[model samples]
Target: MVSKQAGVDYTETFSPVVKMTTIRTLISIVVKQGWKIYQLDVNNAFLHGDLHEEVYMDAPQGLAVASSRLVCKLKKSLYGLKQASRQWYDKLTEALHSRGFEHSVEDYSLFYKKSANSSVYVAVYVDDIVLTGTNLVEINNLKSFLHDTFKIKDLGQLHYFLGFELLYREDGVLISQRKFTTELLKEFECLSYTAVTAPLECNLKLQAAEGPLTDPTHYRKLVGKLNFLTHTRMDIAYSVQHLSQFMQDPREPHLKATIHVLRYLKNDPILGIFISNVPDFNLRAYCDSDWAACPDTRKSVSGYIVMLGDSPISWKSKKQATVSLSSAEAEYRSIRMVVGELIWLRRILIEFNVPCDTLTHVYCDSQAAVHIARNPVFHERTKHIEVDCHFVRNSLQDGSITLPCFHY
Candidate 1:
């Protein structure tokens, strides 16, 4: 369909949506504050966007037209148009701005409106929206307004949205993709496969050209779905990350390891992160790296998890861009990556009126890396990673974060 459109019809196709991190962060806060969650769906969402560019389309197949040569001039955006999403987002922004809602600079898709007794947060994923706040009446009124403005359909209470299933409990809210996982398992014929205790084998190393090549299409499709599952299932994050490296030219060993992850999912598809109701907003992070983990490129893998109190809101397992000469350098670079996330998360929390005056604790496994980050002294060992050292040290110096060594 994109091939059918001309260059003048659309220029920008990139549309920002609410981030998964922001969604998790807000859900954690909602559970902590014991606020209500609501869901809204916009009917024919793309059709509401007003078009600014001059465009013409062929008339409908059954329409009674005066001539076959006549084309219809477009005034509103329609589905399949490249610019529909951007136009609709602009229209939604205007409508919300008129109602005192201010879009968050931290996250454009997130809009917040505050009054004397209430603060309402609305997260937009295109047409689907997740609304939450302390005031029930104000939330209902906003719902009414959105319906009147966009012909919205109220789904009521947020049990499911974006393939994630929410389970409210006495302790906290449980978010999972059990239904999605089940379908994934069944579709891949892994439902009846033997389950594994772990997603990947200990000390597992996959080579790009170790074995005969397999179907790249099948391997890529399975890996893509597994990547989406990692949103709720952090346990598979590392395995998915490792498996994705062989997508372009997958081999037999790569497919086997991928199937191992599928069996791990079959072991317990219901396993998910639990956002607790603890009244703590402190940010704590743990970062570590596997030196020379990749046998092919000898690139170390960086893994980190960020916790807001006991709830894990953000995490990642990625391969480093460059080879590190030492384990300490790899660890130092790992900490540097998390510091960026910590600062950005602090900004988001501050916007939510949460006090983040205390320094965040960043625990690392390598004492040498911690020493390198804390000490300003430079040596041959720290020369290559001076840029990373400066970043971590600056964050440490400003009281934004503290580097603490964790004993194994």
Candidate 2:
């Protein structure tokens, strides 16, 4: 055990993460079909792989050895090795490939195998694996195979994985972080605060604090967790994204606003996105932007929500990378990002063996932006745009995407 005393650079061992949106999309489809879901945890996952590099440690100065300069070479990866996770992934991928599972080209962690009668889907998050399939026989065989090959603790059903509390129903699954949120509220000593209807004031704009905080670490940590909570809590997405900007030098007002978010959570700790049982596979997207909302940097905020049927699977509210001279440019930039996500989402659906939605609609509130996208001319104002937003326009022309007239 003492051979693992030294820590390795986690960054070097970092593996690709399957997007949460992908997970949500998969869940929406699977739950709609009433498929069984199971989870598995690999014990000492990182230690199962062999080390390729010659990792060596110098002998202790006082220790007697044949040669003072002799070094010890590592044959297997330890828990903290720089290559541990990557090596483990390699070994796992090899094993899965041998078992007729194909690693997805779009999302590497997603492994699947489809036959005439059965299909199995596996979503991997580090050592934790969530399994779902149409055939229980195949799933059990794979589970037993994995257990014999690697020490796996099978956690029955997808009840709780990665802090998400899952309550399955005949209709669909209700996923929330009630326990996590409650503990977070108490951790921040805000369990007694009054709840509010909204997390942030409607017309108010937040900026960096006037002066340095007493201890900025607490403020940073609190905001970080709040941001993670946005994983399942879309109601607080905009507010958390707004407050995340001031993590470097947070002030009292920022802390107060963050506490406002926690209090909002206190309003409904069980508040989360509900995956519905609706069988509709139509893809619907709405993207909007607030131009020059940031008082400090004068950057706009771009927001979009993608729905599988009526339930949201992906949403984001983030500040624009570049300052848009006009509101139209900001909205147009948001269009670019959302369309890219649409393309990626469609590819993921195909990988899941789900049929593509024939008519995908991307709605934008800015009429001027829609007009500009439809008429892609090198206008003097749009000349400054780095990437042309002609993709959505082409989708419209090709009869794939329809820009419905916006009302209200």
Task: Name the best candidate (by lDDT).
Answer: 1
Residue-wise lDDT of candidate 1 within 217-336, one digit each (tens)? 888999999999999988899899999998888988888898899999999999889999988889999998999899999999999999999999999999999999999889888998
Worst 10 residues of 1 by lDDT: 1-10
- Writing each residue's lDDT as its tens digit, candidate 2 over 1-408 gives 223333542235667666788778888888877788899999999888877666776665587889866776667877656678888888787888888999888898999999987899988888888899898998999999888888999999788888888877676778888888999999999988899889987787877747557999999999889877887998888998899899888988888888888888899999887888878888989999989999989999999999988778999999998899999999988988788788888888888777885878899999988888888687887888886466777777877677777877
**Distance from true location, Cα of 376 in model 1, Å:** 1.3
Off by over 4 Å in 1: 1-6, 212-214, 386-389
Error of 1 at 345 (Å): 0.7
lDDT of 2 at 226: 87
lDDT of 2 at 163: 82
